[model samples]
Target: MRQHQNRSLKERLSNSAFCHFEQRGELPCIVVQHPGFTASLLPQGAQLLSFCPSGDTSWIWLSPTAEYQQGTSLRGGIPVCWPWFGNADKNSPEVQAAMAEGQPLPAHGFARTNRWTLTRLYEAADRVEIDMSLPQSHHIQSVWQGDAELTARWILTPTSMEMQLITTNTGQSTLAFSQALHTYLPTTDINATRIGGLSGHPYIDTMTGWQRKQQQGDVVFQGETDRIYLQQASPLRLVTPQRTLLIHSRGSRSTVVWNPWITKAQRLSQFEDNAWQTMLCIETANAADDWVNLAAGANHCLSLRLTVE
Candidate 1:
């Protein structure tokens, strides 16, 4: 038994060594080898993780979890939550309750927790693809009997990044849903930076003592800001004096931006102290109570590509 175990270990080591050797070349995809940077591609999309050695800048993109952890929670990297998209109720009751009946999932639906299968891995280009079948979940099947295909493709370039999500309805009936790419970007100071894009639109302010009002210019961060802007036609941009990160998307009809200031951040133990200043949530989504109905044999696609300059 001991000898067998040793052989197994040796085989595993040999496989790893050979994988590394095969990856060393002008391959189209490559895994990032830096201390805090790792890249992978599934049948869905490419996912990149960039963190400090101290584990501070750790960010994950499931390429499939696009809802941005709802408007309430946005500290744990950028999750692409999907299906029943945005808020059904702006104030009380919240959207989770509205989705309780006849709905296959909770507020933002159950796309995030499902285990995605990796279909392809490119060693030279740092890319991966993940794929999942929707309406296949036990909960979803009980509520809505249908089959859907969701594919997420993530590609990491030397200077920029890209993610694509494609959903196809394979069942006989139509599928109704909403989607979003929840992005949580790390920053030195959220207050110092201004979020561009929705310059002249009205926003429902979720901060203390502030009434819902129309924003005059580009949305700037003074204190804590959490609002879901309606019918925004512009792309989302996180602008700082030092750098600017542009989030461009297609097939999404709504956009959400959120930040938990000092008080809210303190209450959440996972995000303590000045963690608020280090992160900002800018999501590209389809919400505002909008439902997408895809007929059988129809497919819908949503994509968000980020470029940091």
Candidate 2:
């Protein structure tokens, strides 16, 4: 049955000029080779693994040792954190209360590990667009009791790559969730990497007992860092020795900046010990004190746009 499905998917996607199905170890993925850029996307979790614009190196950072197997989350690109971000116990009460009693909650929810259904693919002279949705099935029912639908869309153009995460409440009651576009970007030198547009904003320092502190200047990497900046209002500029990337977001009031540095990098899966020095995460999020509550039949959309110069 699995083989038949793979064959059908391959035939269907292969008809497109720029998109086709390919196997990556134990997993199946779509490879898009548009005139503007090239991208690799996995239906599993609807995860994007790589994006390289024409004439430039990859703006997205994927792990060298990342695994491509069933039931395992890849270590890089943009992981769609959904339903709840991080520890369920740390989420807002409304999000926590929605989970089934005594059900084991995985970090960053279950969206990233489940296979999503491809819903749409459209190509044009200058761009390509793709959409995938999380199917309601045993995977969802096992962890959640509410009825909600998740749809992710991507648009690739010569100058930018954009993503939108849309959540709809299909149940009769209200729905609550936290989510993030956990984007990992690469840097040739971590010491020279700096993030702008967050000065004076307050952040929760998760590594320092979750204390709240103010951002005094452009955020720079020094050691193991995990922070959730609150009430963010502007786009973030990531300046590295390799290139400059701009991150613009909507429907997000928080941004998570993280790097495992050295010590924790040794313990991370699908990551090399020195990988931390070359990658940093600037997540556009609705997490920590920022969460979403949707009324019955309502929908919410979180979007992120990435451009390099």
Candidate 3:
């Protein structure tokens, strides 16, 4: 919201060949049009709305019916879930303690709804670098009293894209929180999709009463599926008929895989009733037993990388 910052952003973007700022639908977004790929970024939530390598369908699936209104998160791309994940009651006691008693907590925290300031932008022959941060304000403190700063960095290349969410505890107290890079990936067919590298891991089946279970083999879609894999660090492969996407992560122990097949898809916002057929969410996370705790002046980062072949 700083006038000088906006001026700098406009000036730099105006001088770029591959990147520019444009109004998409109802929101202003940054657009990248490199010879190798094209991507769109929204300042709200610091979200990547779309990314497509040259000659390929978009790897990031955005709902056709999605609205671009403010304060509402779009149905796809990488939604940054922070401070706490899922429900307020489901967070760790320390994280839950930060919230006011008897107040309703929004799912996935408030970071995604608040606008972030673009702090850095750089473009090169082979890649583009972008950095943004959430400015601290009374609106943030009213929900979670802890003082924390969040920054998002994006690195884009011809063949791949990487995102990093950095959290710094700027205040003088210990803080606890959970977060995720909720990436919605596109698939030619959801039923034909299989996720590898989680065969032997333990998971919490949120769809089945949060039951603890072990994965039998590759994960495949049937009905609605929602599972939280615990302590996961290995790379995962999302295989479909047309192509395969390799997903890598760092600074995260938990991973979440979700798909709303039929029943729930109709009830979601910014989503078509049948939109679940083409998207799957495989999130890199610090969640549940793997929640993060940062001492004063400490910082933590959660990153995700995606490559398609």
Deviation in angstroms for 15 in model 1? 7.2
| Candidate models: Cα lDDT each | 0.53, 0.91, 0.88
Please identify which of the two predictions, 1 or 3, would achieve the higher lDDT against the true structure: 3
Mind giving the per-residue lDDT tens digits that candidate 1 earns over 118-166? 4443434333232333335565455334467777666554445567778
Model 2 Cα lDDT, one tens digit per residue, 45-127: 88988889888888899999999998788999899999899988999889987787778889999899988878899988799
Tens digit of per-residue lDDT, candidate 3, span 3-29: 555466677689887989786665678
Model 1: lDDT equals 0.53
Q: lDDT of candidate 2?
A: 0.91
What's the count of clashing pairs in each model shown? 34, 0, 0
Model 3, runs deviating above 4 Å: 1-9
Task: Please give the lDDT score at residue 265 for candidate 3.
Answer: 94
Query: Which one is best on lDDT?
Result: 2
Give residue 184's error in model 1 in angstroms: 0.5
The estimated TM-scores of all candidates read 0.69, 0.98, 0.96
Question: Using lDDT as the measure, what is the rank order of every candidate, best first?
Answer: 2, 3, 1
Model 3: weakest 10-residue lDDT segment is: 1-10
